[model samples]
Target: MQKDKRTSLTDGMFLSLMKSSLKGISQVILIENAVTGFIILMAITIFSYPLGIITLSSSIIGTLIGKLGGANENNVNSGLYGYNSVLTGIALTLFLTGPSQWFIALVGAALAAVFSAAMMHFMRNTGIPILTFPFIILTWFMLLASYKLKAFQLSPGLVPQDLSHWTLNISGKVDWLEGSFNGIGQIFFLDSTLAGILLFIGVFWAGWKYGLFSILGNAFALLISFVLGGEHSLIILGLYGYNAILTSIAVSIVFKEDHNRFAPISGIIAACVTVPLTASVATWLLPYGLPALTMPFVLSTWLFLGARKVLPRL
Candidate 1:
């Protein structure tokens, strides 16, 4: 019985970790199981301890709340109710600084859980997945409201990189490659190449297709940004590429199962389209200090998926 108890505890912890990792990609559960999920969290934690802890806390809290509210057992166990909370916590942590931010993190995470449930229910009949809309909505409100309170300030380290010293030559090429890796890491608020490497490994361990698409997505965005004469500094900082990476991976790997020829083509197109769209959207929201979050990915995927339903051949 003691051995059985230990096994059960281990299993429960693994499931929770998987749920937490799934926040990085809502449909990761479709590609990999609990073991892969655990590996992904290990990679994320190894990259950023605070991010890992906050993600785990929010996921567990959301899952518990969802279970108590009599949410579908399958949805709860599969992390459908938890991923948005993880994103909310990560978002708050990334943007806010100081001690009060911790308190806000907790409350924000809880509110995210509640909103996620409500959003999921309201959209149930629409047949469209809510995705990270709950996280986006909650984080936007928190960030906008934080401007009113003096306790909140943006992290000093979150500054844009200065690239006036470098010309778009050999060094630029190196920066782009490193930036591509950083782009993957930035999804979890990590800005290190090591973290990106680990994340790539984790995704690859889950399935090669996931890993491949992630790299492809980052590359596609970089190329598109260059052609569009976007600032090389933002690209090197990985600021302009992360959402496109996610958008590409989601449309290709998660929703479309057949690996249809158009699936990857569509993903590439979405990534290219989102780069300009993200920039344009950010321009409009400049007064709010909002960074567009993952709306580029969310909106692009929604458009593609919705269009696919009608176009069929797409």
Candidate 2:
């Protein structure tokens, strides 16, 4: 009977860890459903098999660190540690190209978990979620490190330019269907139309309301960027849409409190805010050859969430 109990306990722990790792993928979008994460994984794999592997591998690494490091069990199970690692892993793998990129990507993923733990410890009293700040900062640092490191190679798509030479060009026709799907796909650093559709299915699978917010957020961001005369190539490519999708979901659904009565309205506003934020952040990073990543989402979400502390109804 004692041996049987030990075996059962081991199996239970393994199952729990698997579930947490899966939840970590979905948690990238601020959802904690394992099934949703699995669908998202499928979507990612369909577009890039390597990315799909890193996504799940990074999540598992994060969960394992949290589990073994004696962190709060609830936080580990909630997939909080896994999300940052997921983003970090994907970003590093995509932004850096070399034989050692895979190794660096895994290392970055592990560090993301540690970084998230540190951030959580520091922000515990602030009554605000860290969101993907750790991922954003870590990715920027690692990408910048490529400039000095011999083993790290930056992708050709990222080219540093003199601000004096920058020119604004906002002249291209938008592909509505492609833009619609690209927004969701870019969340995982993807641009595949099929992957985007699958991502939407995964989101709706989590909850219809969240799916609605995501669509509304992407649509609003695209429209706002178009009207604001953002570069047509960037707007149509869904560069501006990913941040809005994240902000809308974070503000209205994920971080919302039961007592915050106007969360939905504020959520839309926050989503739209990301359009301009994206342009500004991208331009700021142009000199360094860095993509904006999720800073726009973090900024807009933090804005509304911090405001709600002073006026709880916001």
Best-fitting candidate, scored by TM-score = 2
> Which regions of candidate 1 are displaced past 4 Å?
1-32, 150-174, 257-261
Instruction: Please give, for residues 1-314, the per-residue lDDT of candidate 2 as tens digits.
Output: 99999999999999999899999999999998999999999999988898999999999999999999999999899898899999999999999999999999999999999999999999999998899999999999999999899798999988998999889987869997798899988999988899999999999999998999999999999999888888878876899899999999999998899988799989999999999899899989999999999999999999999999898899
lDDT by residue (1-314, candidate 1, tens digit) is 99999999999977664554464333332333455555556666887787778877777777777777887777777777677777788889888898888778877887887998898889778656777788888988887776588776666544433444434432344387788888877676667877778777777877788888888888988888777777777778776678888788777767774736788888878877888887777665665557777777788888888888787656
RMSD of each: 4.6, 1.3
Q: Estimate the overall C-alpha local distance difference test score of candidate 2.
A: 0.93
Clashing pairs in 2: none
What range of 10 consecutive residues in model 1 has the weakest lDDT sum? 23-32
Per-residue lDDT, model 2, residue 114, is 98
